[model samples]
Target: MVTDTAFTWSDAKRECRNMGGVLGVPSSDEENKFIGQLADGVVWIDCNDLEEEGRWKCREVNVEVAYRNWMSGEPNDVDDEDYQQCFTFMYDDSSCPESWHYWGNSCYKITETALTWSDAINECENLGGVLAAPSSDQENEFIAQLVPDDWTWIDCNDLEVEGIWKCRDDNVEVAYRNWFYGEPNNAIEEDCAALAVATWGNK
Candidate 1:
């Protein structure tokens, strides 16, 4: 309910954590309504299944969700991102319209809007997938051919520990790498990396 702040679900939860609070999770219907009224925009709730798909945990207190207020047709497990179920509340209901592209066994989509690494990763999860990680060379090449923009975010990042890259979805180290020449010098504080459209468009 911090109106002065605008943040993605994960970031919002982190914000609350930093404040020695978890993003608020209403344990009752009355409290849910009160929280929804706290802001004109959707408010992030402390509930998600970042670790285990189909299982949700409260971000604040580690409790199983008992109360409920999901918008209709929600928790759809969209785009196969079954593990990304971060919850949010708006005075009115809201959902991100997902557009998907089938790639092998996975569905992929580059967000129309840009979000920070954490936010992007979270958003992708909530949609039932992780930010696309090409697990094999062929998958990488196929994904490379689908770029429609000058740049797009990829899930690999070294934010938690420099020089060690891992997939956001499972925290598994990347088994393959195709870094651009002298790439990942991390010339700036750009800890996040992505599949640059210009760099990977042709495979």
Candidate 2:
């Protein structure tokens, strides 16, 4: 079966379980081909807890039959941050494994040039749109192309407080952030929104 809504890995697993079938974890070339034909965009699979490095558990256990298709340098597992990991079948340069620390499955739309956060939002709104929320690898790649070497503002900022940032369009929590470790301290004087320089190691 297929679904149209976006769901977190855990939630997708639960929904699949309740439906009396496992989440579609395609195991063979043929299965993956079928899955591709079955749906587009990111889809949940039955692979998590990738290496037992932690309590990596998924809804199903199919150890002998692993179905993997990661782009180059994938599953980097940098920083050893968390035991929980989910997989998206598409490749996105904006979501390079090294930078996973600061982003999530959000989409973006590029304009002809960079603009302030407010201006960017206004441009999107004027076109009957909101800030982009990329959910697929294809969308991520497209957004990456729009990014110049210089920084650009995405429609994101802290809403609840001065520094608790989120995408302006839907308040989606920023899963990944490239800000300097101690930056965005929410200094009362500089509580606006901006993006990181593509060449910089940190914001």
Candidate 3:
């Protein structure tokens, strides 16, 4: 029941958490309807599926899926080799978009009350949890809801070094994740990981 504006995806999420709400994830028909009526335009939801595929789950438990609005050719396994699959919504087009399709549209949840990505990551590491990777479908759905008209960053990255993908704290099992086509190219200078800002077709 909160309406937030004029803030980045990370900022908005922080605000929600401050009010005892970790972003809004509308699952049931009632929840969706209520969320739609409560807010306008693009807002943050608690959906993310960054860790494992086909395991979508909401940030808040017991939420039901009342709507499934994914962009065309969505949830594709193009980057399964890199395990970089994540979900988010684009206001420009009402389709289910993946990380490679539109990198910038991605959203993330903060485990701490920090403001920048660097700060967030540092806090997560301090707690033995490097941010959080979406391990369920509900997480993906929740992320899709929060995506505003801009690109955001998730906890996934290659902080171990550069151009080497690894989850928080250098977990070896994380190597078995997915990525988009021709992704993780690193491009020499492109060491850090970031969600693309342009749409799929444009990029």
Candidate 4:
């Protein structure tokens, strides 16, 4: 019963209960493997330490998490952010490529040479990645900070269907957009989208 749509942790828990099940809290190695395989990507489980740092518990069942599978050096509270206590899982334990930045289960890197959106897509593909396609505000900010004060090409476009944008990386319809005022106007039949000064437009 994996829901592909994104939801806050609480919302997810409630949704799970509504379906007559609790949040997926693996209690054993086999359960962990099953849940990890079920969730092909980062997914919210029931594990969190919000009540007390370093004391993880499954909120739905009100039980301490006994089986742990923390990523290397993880659960260490990266950047010491107090709210970094929730847990998600995937089997991806490999490291990111050299010079590539890692965040939210993805690796990112900026290109040295400038190219048109089409060429940029090819460049990234050649390097074993897609053109950066941020799916959330935090991810957008992460990419923006990578190359501040400059426009960067993301894999967003409406070329396949005017006004219907998607991230070419996975051809998934974009659910998050940060458009500039009066932008995406498709001026002169514009199709590609880009981040301009941290705002998005198809100009």
lDDT, candidates in the order shown: 0.61, 0.52, 0.46, 0.72
In the range 98-171, model 4's lDDT, one tens digit per residue, is 78766666678888898999999889889987787777666676677678878888888888788988774466
Residue-by-residue lDDT tens digits, candidate 1, 150-178: 56677777777886666644555566766
Candidate 2 lDDT over residue span 27-104, tens digit each: 544345445544567576765555566443433444444456654665566776332232334434354343221223
* Candidate number with the higher TM-score (3 or 4): 4
lDDT of 4 at 145: 68
Against the true structure, candidate 1 reaches a TM-score of 0.45
Location of the lowest summed lDDT over 10 successive residues in candidate 4: 80-89
Worst 10 residues of 3 by lDDT: 194-203
Q: What tens digits encode model 3's per-residue C-alpha lDDT throughout 1-203?
A: 55645665567667877877666665544345335434555556655455567554455544644455444775465655222112323233233223212122333343324245566667656654455443334343344444544433445666567666654323434333334467766665553333332211111
Candidates 1 and 2 compared: the better one by lDDT is 1
Clash count, candidate 2: 8
